[model samples]
Target: MRDAVGRRTFLKRSAMGSAASLTPTGLLAVGAGQAQKPAAPSERVRVGLIGVGVRGRDHHLRFLGANPRVEIAAICDVDRSRADFAGQLALRGSKRRPLIFGDFRSLLDRKDIDAVVIATPDHWHSIIAIQAMEAGKDVYCEKPLTLFIAEGRRMVNVARQYGTVIQVGSQQRSDWHFRRAVALVRRQRIGRLKRIVTHLGNPGTTSGAFINPGVWEPVQTPPEGLDFNMWLGPAPYHEYSPNRCHFEFRYNLDHSGGRITDWGAHHNDIAQWALDMDASGPVRIEGKGGFNKAGPYDYANYLEVHYTYGNGIELVCENEHGNGVRFEGSDGWINVTRLRLDASSPEILTEPVSGQDIRAYDEKNKSEEIPGTDEHHNNWLDCIKSRQRCAADIETGHRSATVCHLGNIAMRLGRKLEWDPDKEQFVGDAGANILKDKPFRAPWRL
Candidate 1:
């Protein structure tokens, strides 16, 4: 996924997300539950991890195991072997071994799990996270936040009703370079914002598009330890195909929104943040895409999208701007990615941002320690104790995901559509509005 950070970055910041008020054996105070005192700074938050696949087992475990502020209380996965493997990792790192659950619901029911770290496939994100929040567990869910737009709204609603501290795993907010770039733009170092542009590489290579009309990937019986049906979760069942499971799932429209949601979850999120439109989004959208093949991998493989926010700032996300977010203003433009941050004039980036300027995150004094070095993950842990909002909170994630969703919707419709950001729906188009939510396979419901 776009969020996989190299191990070396952990020295400064690892992955990004949130934490919770948890029991020594359980969780902290949920919004709907009784009001409890804020956690003591030194109190360890008990954490349950769901989806011990690559992102969860490899990166999340690596970071959480190292953070002294958190205890890996339990792990859940539809795959028994995967669950057992991650349980061992948590056991090796902590003084106590974590409990393993074949089903995530069992883990959520535990009073000992103060917070849940969800790295499940896109289709399962909304269901698990909403349930976790309802169970009084705080959350740190990986990006794309939802399989679809409506799910994100429900996740946000639960967070509000329960006062759950849900953080989206959008770690770029924790990157110092990204933080600086955002602050510079907000400080108007680039002058009045005129346009924001972004480019994500072709979805085929980038999103692992394996199902083509000509090439067929055989569907076979699931591996011995995998609960294939459970793995499918709320999504409709397709016979087991290696091409459609785990890392390869993004290419499918049912499970993901291809590059529009994959990479857009990151850059478009940065776009939303830079534009200072975290709580709101654009009012109009139009885009075009190429879906030449009628294959198992159905989402667009290529596209360009344009959004007009109420303020008239134009945001263009296409395939040619290079892989980053660029802000073009009246005076100059600043382009930023996970790599170097550059501007039309070096003098623009050199401009100092004062206390009077917008601090995308409060990184001034506390930028080096506590929530500093490991800004993203530690920011969530710190907020868990302080009862503060995380850098990439649930609502923020929803709004950003909305940008990508709108673009994808525009591509499918191939028309200019009006969106009411306040209503979070299409102005008058029933067909486009229908696309906002998806149908569940069976017992699962949004």
Candidate 2:
């Protein structure tokens, strides 16, 4: 039970008992959900990959390619060079080379594809996922889930309607430390929760710094072999600029919500999970930050937002509190980051919750041992086969992303706004409500 919550915990809870339908007597069971179990071991799952950029190649492609039960069926990217490169990688040491696709729609049309892995820019997340689901394919979409709050709602609805297994790329949910911390909080190990302070690092990249200003001018022409127009997708068409594409896209408001949505998506997700608010959000939020007023990057460089949950729990989202999340309660507090887990009292880390006390989330399915991106992908795959919800289900992702979106809306508005989580709208604030959704360019509407 070392990495119990890792994969062992999942299996332990899933295998606790079997329903009558799966039992020796073979009695009909009520509400025994159905899942598309793999027909055979040799029947490999055909997967199509869209967006072979940094995360797509390093995480999705690499991990999916390593899964013996999966076949890298097709690779698609707006950039021809990237697509070709991914195709070659998928075809490496294999007799059947994966087909290369410049357009994701072409990849989605193939009946051979059972699922799709999307690592596209944030703005394109919802559209591609919705289309893929509509086309009868499960989706493994990258984090921040959507560009706007409304899009997450649409994704949740579509996922349920199609019964598609949609797993948002919030890999932290699968981490041992996070899972343990969530268990502790749920068991009241931290006592009555008082506040949560999350450090999202920065808006630009994982390096925790923004791109230097005045380093490069926007390019007049799109780079060769890159379909910049198609890359923009539903986002408003902006002139192709090297600084405005790829990793830098997170800094652009048109493409991303700066650090608010970038890192906030990850840390805020943990905060929501600990607070048991995966399906709801804060009632009031507001903050202020310094934005790149006159630079190629438009996201806030230094920002802080405060949220007031209905239960009076205060959550602070900032870029300067250092990396990770800190949860404070009346008795003690615990702080968790990717690298370390610290607590006010050392015993908090030592004390293990009993089975009855551990109530963070229900478990299901005994999956294979895989860690990091591989583990998260495997979790989604296991859940897909078992018809179980993913660790980071679409609703969980939507709520987490909504928290980030709310912070961004509050930051841009520079005023406290009352939020109606039940209705998913701002209370009597036309301007704030207007920011809930962004308009798509011609022929693109979610």
Candidate 3:
């Protein structure tokens, strides 16, 4: 299970003098994950845009369009209107007319494209990114990385095999505040790390449902201008529902793990980053919550999960815990979110970071804008040029997503489960093991 890079779980003593344990799952094995250098393109890197919905149009297109060195080579979406809108937006500031396609494969077929921006729903992230990388294109994929834990593992293997540059869209890793917080934790400024509290918002309701009705809604015909089957790629086929497609899809378990993976992908990721657990995850998870038993939305609603890491650190994921990561050590604690950072003592944030202090992944020229001017996206573009690792690399994304998946599994199963992080499997639960991967609809396989 050792990867292309020589990364392995290392035993580190907590301030309390306890050593962390890791499973032999081979996930810690890290090696050179970079793809062999592609033939260098000209000054501007050519990119293919996939899933031109809200995030695709707003964040990716706007940022790539703003960058002088990036050309939107192609745009693809199941929805024709969204694709056309993104194509027109991508055409701005570039001499080359961007190609518009209804399918992502057509965009991947173009040798002119060097990389891809994947803003599709959670279910589509793994497949499209893997296909794009296999086609010799680097990828910038949105967060959570996969629809299931197995998909995330497969994604890591494929990326390593292709030597492609893949960055997960967890922008907090590139934030100055997050970096500083991680550095301080590594420096033991907060004494020894003990526990982390993460706040992810509540699971949302399903489309066109009032409560848990326990009855399947009648399937509806596909909407005009949208390819319903294509949109459900790799997922179990069901009658089309407007709520199952767009932004509301996150609340549906068929496509996503709801807020557990949605916002958990963000906040729990920070907990992993600060605790140096990006390459590993929890050894025990126990959760309980309310499910949408009466509504069309089946994802968990009110959920709370407690995770215990190999090193005896506890991570609590809950609703209303406040939206951020709070690291509690022996001396004090520091909490950080998108809004701002608050610490038990001001000195934690004020202390000067030393050269030897643990630092977050770095951009060669921090001052120069990367592709999106948004630090996380920019890191990926810069890595494409330098063949370096992005802030939220594939491994990091997989590990973090696993935490969320494990929480969902624990809650859904209504049990306290023992996990072997190294083995990446349940200790003894046969039923839990069955959930690592899911059955996709016919004609779609990973």
Best by lDDT: 2
* 1 against 2, candidate with superior lDDT: 2
Model 1 per-residue lDDT tens digits across residues 1-446: 11143212321131233233311111111111111223332256789999989989987887886676677889999889989989888887567889999899999989867899999889999999989989988799999998778888888888877767677888877666666778888878888999998767633232222223223578899999899999897898889988788877888877888878888888889889988898999999999977647676777777789999999999998764457778899999998766667899989966566533465633353245222244577667655655567788888899988899999999999989999999899988999999888889999986
lDDT values for all models: 0.77, 0.78, 0.76
Worst 10 contiguous positions by lDDT, candidate 3: 6-15
- What tens-digit string does per-residue lDDT give for candidate 3 at 1-446? 11232111110111123212211111111112222233222545688889888888998898777665567889999999889888877777666789999999899999878899999999888889888988988899998887788889889889777666778988777765566677677778899999998877532311121223134556688768899889988888877877678877887888988878988888889899878888899999999878877778888777889999989999998865446777899999988766566789998877666433355522232233222246666567656654556778899999999999999999999999999988889999999999888877777666
Give the per-residue lDDT digits (tens) of candidate 2, residues 262-351: 888888999998888989999999899787777877788888899999999999988765678888988899988876678899988787
Q: Model 3 RMSD to the real structure?
A: 9.2
RMSD of each: 8.5, 7.0, 9.2
Whole-model lDDT, model 3: 0.76
| Higher-TM-score candidate of 2 and 3 | 2
Give the per-residue Cα lDDT of candidate 1 at 255.
84
Per-candidate TM-scores read 0.86, 0.87, 0.85
